[model samples]
Target: MYSWSCRFGLMMAAIFAVSSGQALAQTSAPPVKASLRLDWKGGGQHAPFYLARDRGYYKDEGIDLDIISGSGSSDVVKQVGSKAVEFGIADALVLVQAAEQRVPLTAIAAYYQRTPIVVLSPQSKPVTDPAQLTQGVKLGSKKGSATFQGLTALLAANDIPMQKVTLVDIGFGVQPLLVKQVDAMMGFSMNEPIEAESAGLPVTVMAIADHGVDAYGLMIVSNPDLIAKNPALVKGFLKATAHGLSDAAKDPAAAVAAVNNAVSESDPARETKVLDRTLPYFQSDDKEAHGAGWQSESRWEHTIAIAKKLGLVERDLSAHQVFSNDMLPH
Candidate 1:
């Protein structure tokens, strides 16, 4: 038999080997760093992303996401195309325009199923029909904005002459409407109507969709090169995002709270109300059938047709060239 000391020495060596192996197994790889560019300033519409970050959903997916604000949806497209950001949220119509310009961007997921563009007017003098907008009725809109393009498309598709209504360039904000600078304004269903109501100005909202303008709204976008080289990263980010959105849909209050906590400038009460109004746009018949962020081919065709009609795109780009469902989680 071996001496006791020799047996004890062997046992000690075994213990050390086991400890080292455990330590190696416990080591974790560093989280992948990625930046997400929002279409515009942070608001209730951005709650899902903030929810994901606040709840450590992104960390669970091995991604360290940096969510940044954007000047506009069109600018977000350019930012993603130039690789300034790995991903971006932008208007799907803008993506079509960008694709036509060969900007090298593709929409991976469509977040807003219904376009939020709307025509806001006082309840007292409600212009319910598109044709009701006539020569004397001044419509305020940011020149060259998606809302303006959407308004123009709605009028054109409905056989309403553009010259019948006057288009006034009113930068951002509802001051023009509140001050009666314009009889009506082109704004978002979730944005301006809420603000108007809060200010005790009852308004009638005419959704562009109700006027025959069928188009996709906000979409998750990325460059083709990113999808080609780091598909796993793209998949992980989308999976986490879908989970966050699912949870947000279940509890919008919690999602809004997450946004309020993450963003210093955010107003919790207002954002809570904003989120309530915004969530409906995130789901539709298509989303209910497939899942959230589902992009239907027919909808894309309609969007492309609208862009073409507006002369927003110079070349004809097929729906496939502008959007891809390949990156969405199964």
Candidate 2:
């Protein structure tokens, strides 16, 4: 896959240089091609990228995005690190952990401002406190998955030892929770919760955000090599993506329609339900009131602190070594 770009950087830089009374001789910039992989399965959650493609935002920027579904968070990190694709969406915790283990990856944009991880249980025996999740309870989720890693982080943060609870693997889908095979399952705030709701299963969504575990969710990541070699391509991808995501939030119905065109998993009724349910997770211009997609400096520091606490990052790791938003779209 090639790095995508619109060849706009040189022109913009030339304008700035000329304004300073500098004799800037400009050469024709070559077109650049870039490929992108997002962590999705053609569901309502991926409406933004779908809208962006249908609206030709990616094409305008010379990006040939090949959207792919990664089953787990680590997979996304691995794929991006190996330069398999230009960018992929993955959880922040997993990325942090992988980076600590020497995996090369960096987040470019934040999808959900809040962490979507949760300790789910029946509405009756809701696992509200960290103390209630004891050894007797059978928790169901997947290993190397965002939910499992997030649960691990949550437990560590709350001082709830993992040995106290019986962790069970439940694979990708939400079947284990729905069948009463497990007391509670760690699931997405928007996705699995909606799946449970659609099946008439009574469940309480205890958002990780509610439990003092705030982190960025669904970030765009790229290889360090690609980032260094072709920053303009990365910036173009982010700008087009921001445009697409912004459009998706304002008109979810239209977003779903575009998603339906590419994927059979997306339809009018089912997808509309998913869109409405997942809408709460999205933060937009209307919600943020001039908020941008970049990570706040203070928030980044807090995230680093969490990583250090969990030993997921080097205690001495400088923030400069971990990330570079110099290529991010403004």
Candidate 3:
């Protein structure tokens, strides 16, 4: 056989070759950087994005996600359509409206299964039924807001004339309601009602969905160009989001903590409560079967019908124009 020195040299060379191969195998490509715009500022509703980022779900998907706060759902749609951002979360109806206007945005997933828009009034006034909102009742809402559009749809569905209720253009903040400036306010079920109750004002909440306005809530949207060009990126982002939402549903406390950690300005307890309230909106009998981020053609048709009723769209938009569930994680 071989001399001792030759044998040792051969063994050393084999060891070096294995070590180099291991190093090469351990090397990973840098993550792809991407941005995601939210419909509103950081809150409990945004826990999934934060949770995904904090838990390395995006990292696992090869995405370096930057979650950006947005002004409103409408604004988010505009941003995504303009390609100001690669992705966004917005109201489903807003996406319908945008698509009708040929905004070039496509919804990839439905994040909230049920609409969260509501009419908040003090218990003292107690406008429980949509029909109860009679003439001379002042309702506060921001002009050109998703809430206003939803309120309009609710009134129309209830056979109530828009002129019967006086519309007050109150920007943001519950001051208009707390100060009695407006008899009722248009708000989100998980937002303003909680604030009103905390401020020692017993509030009556009339969920728009309960009042005959059945529409999808928040949805994840992206530009058609992006979806067509970089489909892998879109699929990867959606996969990470699906994982994040699944984890959030399993442990809301962990999700809330992730939000609180990312947005220190938010009160952890309040965010926790918000996350708790938001979880149900993310699920439904249908979603339970198909999984989170699921979209239905029936829901899209309903939303389009409402948009047409509200005069938000001139022509009927097909479900294909508004949303595509193909990208959702299986």
Candidate 4:
């Protein structure tokens, strides 16, 4: 029989061997290949994902992510819903609309807690209040767009009649406003206003959220099938994305630089300004407490209400049906 000391040493040796083996296995495992389709082409708001990609956050979480620029939020939702891509960044309204159509997708995280829709007018003739929109003001609107829908909802909530304001047909870009084609335009707070400023036209911005048109903005989405089958992977993706968002929040310039590095045509100066405007939408009381990527049930409900008001979704939808905070990092 062996001495007590000898048995103890053998037991320690076995434990060490098992621990080392586990570590080796973890380090040796291959990363899961994942693809993320963005709502639109690369822009300042998309910097965090590029930052995370370049900083190795996703790699640290065993995800080899490929970021793909998309045509629009609706396209991104369809791509994720069809399993054409592993994940996507899209507008919350589009996700709800897609869900109503029997799409197999759900919002995993909210990128912007508040809507980015705003009324933009040149400083020469600024629209200071949404109430002024009813006083024979010409408003630029893109028909069949979420912005137009939001504008109508904003007007109705403020007790302004749609017939009172003259809405002019306009395409994307700030030219319609800059050229005085319309008195003011309904556009994204982070996008057109910045573009107008860059072109030497200072403008007044009336945020729709401030006028009781609150709705969730862009969100990260994934199909329910993948989420059900590989919850761990979903959790890891969110954790790594949260890491990117935290880093971006701490050093926004660095995040913009990452975007510049990834997209060949990016303008750093303009993107820096875009990131500045976009950052404020990222925070809320819930995110401050629950951590990044947290989704509020009430906020989702409010979004559904807006979607219903706009006739974007016909079916009844509970807040929980479209989003979950389960995958967010604690």
The Cα local distance difference test for each model comes to 0.88, 0.73, 0.88, 0.89
Cα shift from native, residue 193, model 1 (Å): 1.6
Q: How would you encode candidate 4's per-residue C-alpha lDDT over 207-305 as one tens digit per residue? A: 999999778999999989999999988999999998888898899989999999888899999999888899888898888988887898888988898
| Count of clashing residue pairs in every prediction | 0, 3, 0, 0
Off by over 4 Å in 2: 1-31, 134-138, 166-172, 284-290, 304-316
Q: Give a tens-digit lDDT track for model 3, residues 243-290.
A: 888899898989999988887598988888788879889888777898
lDDT winner: 4
lDDT of 4: 0.89
The C-alpha local distance difference test score for the whole of candidate 3 amounts to: 0.88
Write out the backbone clash pairs for model 3.
none
True-vs-predicted CA distance for residue 216, candidate 2, Å: 2.2
Tens digits of per-residue lDDT, candidate 1, 1-330, equal 989999999999999999999887766667899999998888889999999888888888889999998889878988999998999999988888888888988888888887899999999988788887875888999978878998889988899888788989999888888889999999998888888888888999899988898899899999999999999888888888998898888988889888887777988888887888788888889887877688988999999999899998877778899888898888
Q: Residue 244 error for model 3, in Å?
A: 1.6
Model 3, backbone clash pairs (residues 3+ apart or across chains), number: 0
Query: Residue 289 in candidate 4 has what lDDT?
Result: 89
Which residue runs does candidate 1 get wrong by more than 4 Å? Answer: 1-27
Superposed model 3: Cα runs more than 4 Å off? 1-27, 135-137
The full ranking of all candidates by TM-score, starting with the best, is 4, 1, 3, 2
lDDT of 1 at 159: 91
